[model samples]
Target: MSDDMLRLLPWTTPDGKPCYLSAASDHSRLSLLADDVEAAQLDSGEQVLDGARAVLGDTKAGERAVRFALTRATESLEDVLRIAVSRGERIEAGET
Candidate 1:
C-alpha cells in the first residue's frame, strides 16, 4: 500500500458497524470491523493464506471474507449540537 492509501478515514456504516475508508489503486474500498481492521495477528500474507486454507472450505472464500461488528457510541454535547444544526431544519415531525 502507498502512503496515500494508508491514510484512512474512520467512519461507520448505516447499520452502525465501525469502518474505515481507504484508497486503492483500482478502487476505494471500505472495511467494517470491530477493531483496527488493518492490524491482524498474522503479520505476513503467506501466513494468513496458510491458516485460511486449513480452516475455510475454499481458499478464495477465506481470502475474500472480512470480519465486522456493529456498535453504538454516545455523542458529545458539541457533536449533538453540530448534528442538530446540520439536519435540524431538514426533518419534519412525524415524517420518517
Candidate 2:
C-alpha cells in the first residue's frame, strides 16, 4: 500500500522507529485503538504543558525541576507533532 494509505500510529517500536497502521477503514478495531491512543497522547500533552508552565512560573523551582519539566515537555512535543503530521497526511489524502 502507498504511504498515504498507512497511518502513523501514536506509539513506536522497541528500536524507536515509527509505526504505521494499514487499516482498510477508520472504523476498524486497530483504527479505533489508534484514535484512542492519539486522544490520550493529546490529553497528556495538555497536562504536560500546564505542568511545565507552572514549573516555569515558580521562581523557586530548582534546576532539577526545570530540567525535569523540560524533558517532559520535549517528549510531549514529539507526540503532538507526530499526531499533527498523521492527521495532516490523512487530510491531504482526502481520508479525513
The global C-alpha lDDT for each of the candidates, from Candidate 1 onward, is: 0.33, 0.90
Model 1 earns a TM-score of 0.20
**How many residue pairs in model 1 have overlapping backbones?**
0
Pairs in clash, predicted candidate 2: none
**Runs in model 1 lying further than 4 Å from the true structure:** 1-8, 24-73, 77-96
- After superposition on all C-alphas, the RMSD of every candidate to the true structure, in Å, is 16.7, 2.4
Instruction: Kindly report the root-mean-square deviation of model 2 from the true structure over all alpha carbons.
Output: 2.4
Best by TM-score: 2
Kindly report which residue pairs in candidate 1 clash with one another.
none
| Residue-wise C-alpha lDDT for candidate 1, range 2-83, written one tens digit per residue | 3233332233368855433344432334433312332231233335445444445544453234221001111222233333
Number of clashing residue pairs, candidate 2: 0
- Per-residue lDDT tens digits for candidate 2, residues 11-93, read 89999899999876888898899899999999999999999999999999999999999999999999999999988888877
Best by lDDT: 2
